[model samples]
Target chain A: MNLIAFAILALLAATAVTVARMRDLWAAIMFTGIYSFLSASWMLILDAPDVAFTEAAVGAGIATVLMLSTLALTGKEERATTRSPLIPLLVVTVTGGALIYGTLDMPHFGDPSDPIHLYPNPSFVEKSQEDMHGLPNVVTAILASYRGYDTLGETTVVLTAGIAVILILRRDESHPEQQESP
Target chain B: MSIEQVVGLYNYWIVVFLMMTGFYIVIARTNLIKSIIGLNIFQTSVFLLYITMGRINGGTAPIIPAVVADAHAHAHPADAHATDGPAGHSLHETADELIYSNPLPSVLMLTAIVVGIATTALALALIVRIREEYGTVEEDEILELDRYS
Candidate 1:
């Protein structure tokens, strides 16, 4: 509708195309940062300032920087001729499409009259004194108290990934490579 | 329909298309950095999804002014008159003033973004060590040496 939104959409599309066609890995990494910034702009246009902030900081800022760092350690040239991955592509396409289609049955974007409002959350704001949790933000209360178990699971996932990374990149102190004297 | 609904809707579709394609690249391709790029796309699409969900119809920026903030103040039972209509109107105004927003997904998204950054950082660190150990970072090179080892 607005110029800003149009610019963001254009940039988003261009970044996707560039990322796809990019031969150099570092250029693709740079475009990933551009893509993230455009996505954050779209988020801001959608009226979620908090989400916009996080997307800009984490998605564009930290994530892009780290990815580029990895690229620096690795070679920039992508494989010249990779094998055709038809089967995996088909599987991923089907699964992702089904999920996107399923999201269509969800409430329209930003509809004021949605099931989200019909939840017990309104009661928390209605009777703040009655809420046993002292948190002012209902979302925090729900995440930390009501759905505490799910958060614990997420923490465990992070822990598992950390352990896996350590194992994958473990040191070779016992078997040092033989060096020749100059 | 407003232009927001018309053009804005397609914006979501583009994100989804790019996202799925990028994810396909990650899952199908063997290159580590390519997989990371694909993961970036996947994460960006989710941010789009959350931001789209948070957009409110007929809603202005959420900054609250001190005077206008009083509009949301609720009246206790003691302050109520013996009339039901005025009480009902007061209650309606209070609820309406504090517009119902689903902040849960957005809050969760914030945590997700942080976790995404952490993962990326850890992944990069691993790649550095992987390069040191293997003398190369390409998947084919690593696999070639791995097969022989």
Candidate 2:
């Protein structure tokens, strides 16, 4: 099990590096899809089946398609960037070092006595076990019932985004000069 | 560090590396679509981080025993008393067998994933419009055109 996890992590790292270096937008898009697939598999190995499903469907499926459609409208290969990468590289290094430092204080992987599981999670589980709501999938129960308002807000965001996209794209089609989009 | 601590911390380190890779791509890439890809990568790394945190060693998926399922299967419409006793007892019994994974992070990620796709779609749509007006999606190129005109 540990070996499988390690292999997946290694593969994920390799793919991210490849995606970063690849200049062909389409190839990078494909690699990003592969990256999502690998991450979804890792999510399953981590016992998060719901998140795995979402990652597969949304990340690999929908996000890839959206990116492809955008690619059809844009240049296939990126023009060489003129800006020196030194500044961004330095920024990433410092930010990543800070994040790693923060993780040093976090609960170790799968530590049973972690305070997260000690308090809030168990309370949520207890709520799931309540007689009024005997939900089998605790994730679904929390998403739909306990945190229904938050999910509702997310849905509203989705709705707003869809409207904004339609409004933006629809204006182009109506333009006399812009007859069709490739 | 000991082997145990390394094993515990390695997952987090991998997550941070992926996050930085995505962040660098967004910062360095000039193409709008590539930046969006970088944004997707950044969001995905976050999802992975959450799911990784929720996993418990030897824990199964977070699915509780279905009390209603058991009740319906055993109750013959006349065994109300027998069903009642088991239904109440089953809930308590679940705690004994509850070696299930944490569900909170998974739930949160579900909504995040939906929002991510929606935002990606919107970004792509705007990119398409930009291509129509500016004749390019390269940020520097578009800005250059804007400067001249």
Candidate 3:
């Protein structure tokens, strides 16, 4: 398993380095796929089959397709050859390192006693014993009923994004004066 | 001292690395398309985090096995007043493997994936329009032109 883990880590590192060095937009997009695919494999190993599937389907599939299309619309190469900034890099590195150190006490991966899983599933599952909402699935009941407000907010966000996308894409100024060819 | 622990321990760090790399690309890259790619990677890492937390060890799922039910019958020794008759048994793996996964996160991830695809498609459509209007997609150049206007 560690062998597979190391392989994934190395693959991701390679993608990162290639993304940095690749000047061609097409090449960069391919490397981005490599990065996402490796990440999905890691997700599978993590016992998160659902997250893995989404990562594979959306993160790797839909996102890559959209990016390639965008690249077609945009110029294939970077427009400006600006020098890199070292200060921002250093600052970001230090801040990220500090944050990682702070998380050192986080529960080890898949610890049975981890608070995340053992927190409250049984209590919620036991909810059927009381109210008799006739819900077999504790998760479904919790989201659709117990915390319906949050789900409503999420649905609203999704609908709003769709509307915004339609509005932005439909903004076509059709009446333009024709200028004579110079 | 088994296969589970090894796969389990390193699973999370891989997610973190991929996530950080993706985030760095999103922030530092001037290309809008590249930033979108980075965003995908960032989201992928998050999905990995959610799924990895759901793995349970040595637990053959919550479903009841037929053999275990049969054993309970003999062990009962003809006790007629047994309230719990191994109801969790006779459940095949068809119930999505009743392993101890918090289905809430999985369901949320599905919604998020749909939302992300919609957002990306919309963004790409907008990028096409931006190209047609501005005749270029470079952010710095666009900013410079906007400043002059």
Candidate 4:
């Protein structure tokens, strides 16, 4: 299990780096899809099957399609940047270092005694069984029932985004010339 | 660090590295679409971090077994007398036997993954509009155009 986790993480890191470095926009988008798929697999290994399903569907599937369509509408190759990369490298290094430092205090991987598993009374797993009356999938039970309002809000956010996209991308039939030029 | 310590913490370290790679792409690159991709990379890494935290050493996914859940469903209707019944006893035993990974993070990330895709779609729409208006998607070119005009 540890070896599988390590290998998947290494693959994820590799794909991320490749996405970062590739100048071809199409290849980069493809690599981003690969990265999402790998992460979804890793989430499965972490016992998050529902999250994995969502990530695979939305991240690897929908997001990639959206990006490819955007690429079709825009340039295919990234233009060479004239600026030096030193400052950005420095900033990322410092931020990554701080994040690594923060991880030192985190619980070891898969430690059952971690505070999250113990806190807030009976834990979500047990509480969910009681409240949901033996729902087979606890994650879905919590999302659709216990945290129903949050899911409603998420739907609203997605609705707003869809509306926003329509408004932004809609061609004005009254100003065909404007659409033609700019 | 010792091998155990390294093994314990390596997942987090790699996640951080993946995040930084995305951050670097966002800040260092000038392409707007590429920035969106970078944003996605960053978001997925955070999701990985949360899911990793929720894992238990021997836990399965947080779905109860169908037989146990069916027993639970049936046992609930006869609650007054079910306490002494075999169905109720088996339900208790099954709960004790199963170790499930934390479900809270999975719940949260399910929402986040949807939101992330929505954000990506919106951002890509904006990028397409930008391309239509400015004739380029490079950030520097857009800035230069703004500066001159």
Candidate 5:
């Protein structure tokens, strides 16, 4: 299991690097899809199949399509920039180093004694069984029932994003000539 | 570090590396669309981090098996001895034996994944509009055009 996890992480890292370096927007978007698919596989390894399903559907599927359509409307190749990369490189290195340091005290991967497994009084798994009356999927019970308001808020966010997209992209029919490319 | 320590912590280190790569792309790259791609990468790495934290060594997915759930449902109304037959007793035993990975993170990440996609879609729409108005998606050129105007 560790070996498989390592391999997937390696592939994920490779894809991220490739996406960062690629000049062609289309190729970069394709590589991003591959990265998302690999992330879904890793989530499955971590025992989060619900999250894996969502990541595969939303991340790899919808996001990739959106990016490709955006690419079609924009330039295919990124123009070469004269700006120096040293500052951004330095900033990222510092932030990453701090995050790695923060992980030192984190529980070992998959340690059952971790606080997340034993917290909030009965934990979500046991509580869901009681509150949800033997619901087969604890994650769904938590999302749709126990945490209903949170889900409702997320739905509202999605709705707002859709409306914002429509407002931004919809052509003005009253002035047809204004719709022409400048 | 020892092998065990290295094994325990390497996952987090790699995730951080992936995140930094994305951050570098977002900050250093000139293209607006590439920045959005970088943002997606950054978001995904954070999702992986949360899911990684929720794993249990021997745990299965957080979904209860159908037979076990059926046994639970049956056992709820009456005492196990009164409600369960021989097969149901075994299913009850199996349910007691099962260990599930943390469902809270899975629940949170599910919502996050949907929100991330929505954010991506909105950003892409903005990028398309920016392209239509400015005739280029490169950040530096857009700023130069603004400066001259």
Candidate 6:
């Protein structure tokens, strides 16, 4: 089990690095799909099957297709940035180090006694069954009932995004330049 | 601190590494599509981190019992033995005995995944419009062209 987890992590790391380094936009897009797939597998190992399902569907599936469509609209090859990569590299290093430092205070992975698992008020893992009216899937209960307002807001955001995209792209399509170029 | 602590927290280190790589990609890559991919990678790594935090090593998925044991209890209130005996299971016992994985983070991340995709769509749409207006998706090229125009 540990070996499998480590291997998935390694694969995720390797994919992320390759995506970072590769200048070919198409290959990088494919690698991003691979990265999402690996993370979904990791989510499965972590017992978040729902999250894994959503990630696989949204991240690897829909996002990739949208990216491909965008690629169709835009250039295929990425022009190498003439600016030095040093500043970004340094900034990422500092940010990563800070995040690692933050994790030191976090509860260890799968620790049952962790506040999220054992705590009663907000985490809701403890009394989700009772509080949510005997709904077996606590995630569903929490999302649909307990946190209904948040889910509603998320749905609204999605609707707004769709509208915004249509409004912007529809305007672009009427342009003579786009028709002439392609 | 110790080997045990490091071993237990190794998952977090992996999360950090993935986060950094994604962040670097977004910053360093000039292609609009590739930057969006980087953003996707960054968002996905975050979901992994949240899911990892909620896991229990030996826990099962959060699901209700297979059979409706409560109906039997209702039919024969006097003989409460069915609820406890080997023949039939108790409704409460299903929840009480099982060490179910935490579902809260999974729920939150599900919404996040949806939002992430929506944002990606919007971003791609904007990239398309940018390509139409500026005739290029590379940041440097767009900046140069826009400045001259």
Off by over 4 Å in 4: A177-182, B70-94
Candidate with the larger DockQ of 5 and 6: 5
Docking class of 4: medium
Give candidate 2 regions above 4 Å deviation: A121-123, A126-134, A172-182, B65-94
How much is the lDDT of residue A104 in candidate 3?
59
| Model 6 lDDT tens row, A69-164 | 888778788887788999999999999999998988888877776777654433244345445555667678888988899999999999999999
On DockQ, the stronger of 1 and 4 is: 4
Q: Model 6 off-target regions past 4 Å?
A: A121-134, A172-182, B67-94
What would the TM-scores of all predictions be? 0.74, 0.87, 0.72, 0.91, 0.91, 0.87
lDDT of each: 0.65, 0.82, 0.61, 0.86, 0.84, 0.79
Candidate 3 chain A: 10-residue stretch with minimal lDDT: A125-134
Q: Which residue pairs does candidate 6 place in steric collision?
A: none
Per-residue lDDT of model 4, residues B1-149, tens digit only: 67987878888998899999999999999999999999999999999999998887888998988876666666666542323433222222236478888888999999999998888899999999888888999999999999998
- Predicted candidate 1 versus true structure: per-residue lDDT over A1-182, tens digit per residue: 56888788888877876786676888888888888888888777765566777788878787777777677777788876477767876887797688767655566666665555344333443333224222344455555666678777667767877787777667657655532211
Q: Which residue pairs collide, candidate 3?
A: A46-B52, A48-B51, B64-B89
What value does the interface RMSD of model 5 take? 5.3
Docking quality (DockQ) for each candidate: 0.35, 0.46, 0.27, 0.51, 0.48, 0.44
Q: Which predicted model would earn the best TM-score?
A: 4
**Cα-based lDDT at residue A148, candidate 3:** 70
Query: What lDDT is reached at residue A33 by model 3?
Result: 73
Better of 1 and 3 by DockQ: 1
- Fnat, one value per model: 0.44, 0.73, 0.36, 0.79, 0.79, 0.73
Candidate 4 i-RMS (Å)? 4.5
How are the candidates ranked when ordered by TM-score, highest leading?
4, 5, 2, 6, 1, 3
lDDT of 4 at A126: 50
Off by over 4 Å in 1: A1-3, A85-93, A123-182, B1-12, B60-64, B71-101
